[model samples]
Target: MRLRLVALAALLSPLAACSTVSEAVKGPELAPVGYPAALVPRDQSVLPLASAREPLPQAASANSLWRTGARAFFNDQRASRIGDILTVQIDIDDSAKTTNATTATRTSGMTAGVPHLLGLESSLGKILPGGFDPANAIETNSSTNNAGSGQVNRSEKISLTIAAVVTSILPNGNMVIQGTQEVRTNAELRQLTVAGIVRPEDISSANTIRHTQIAEARINYGGRGDISRVQKTPAGQSLIERFSPF
Candidate 1:
């Protein structure tokens, strides 16, 4: 009995370890807050190594009040070069409703008869069931009906604001920006990420741009930790649901 118990324990140890490993693999671990390195391009440099052109010394005009390239008290703060920071406004409000109905019906009938066949009709009447008519030798009728109805209603809305850093600049003067924000409440950690391309002209004077202005935009908002894990279905259950034919 002692040997049997020891062997059973040994066999179950691997199964317990496998279950622990599967749980760890199913959920994403909370990431520490830091720069989103994945959004940066490998070939491009985040900061300019040197100025495109050396700035020429502006000769002081003794009589003029304004100098060359000097703006009136205020300056443009829009993001135009790599390494610049700008705010992105995301406001998504969408709703959809669809209904479909299909109905089909068909009916058909066919009749064949042999009233006379070389004087054999009388002989067939005696062999066939009583009250059988020669005029109606074969008759068939069929009907089919099909009806289907479907309805769908969905709605989604999300509003947020995040600051993003310019990662790269295109030849067309567009800038690619990416940002990640993380917040931890107790054990749960919420993460938000945004990345996209935007034109310099679309940026407002306040250095903010709407989400719609960003082309090829990608936004994700989710959480990791105890709460999220509880909300998600177990890995084993999810696998069975996905592979089950019924």
Candidate 2:
């Protein structure tokens, strides 16, 4: 097994080097846009489909200007079904601060003696060291002191908006949503993804919802390009740092 692993590593070394070289030369490329299902799988805490559904509408009148099934005018445009689109507004401004301190001290001492063990104290001078004292046969002392302090401060702010699709409807009327947006400027590619569950009642009449209203939300914002590559540590250095003891 060791020999096989060594051979496999040897074979993959060139490929790894080629990948690193290519990335350094060309920077990082953007990922292609795809279906939200690829990002939010069904098993990712998403609820199952509801067994009951609203009945389909009956056919419209033949001689009427306002068709029963038509969305001509004055119809509610809010997203209420699977595949319908809705806007998601995200505005975050969070901060945190923490401080802690600890101190501990301990001291102990012990002594034991056989001062009158069958009158053997007199013979102890001959059997042991000349200054040996039978009254104090064993003595020990110990002391420990510890002190620690820690502090942390952090802040975050983000503001943006994106459209999301209703992927599923739960039995209790909650909808699971997922969306991804990407933009490329020169050699840089920015990506933003959002997925979560929302209640229809929380949605505004304008078909928009706030990030705070989402449950089990997962939001990601990042980019790839020459700037990111320059800021990132090399894979070899990262591996070494991870395995190093100091």
lDDT of 2 by residue, 1-246 (tens): 999999877766655434344454544544432324565554433344453234223346688656343344545466667778999999999999999999999999999988897877889889997788888899999999999999999999999999999887765567888999999999998989888888876878778999999877888888889888888788666554444434
Inter-residue clash pairs, candidate 1: none
Off by over 4 Å in 2: 1-74
Clashing pairs in 2: none
By summed lDDT, the worst window of 10 consecutive residues in model 1 runs over 47-56
Q: Give candidate 1 misplaced runs (Cα > 4 Å).
A: 1-75, 112-138
**What TM-score does candidate 2 reach?**
0.70
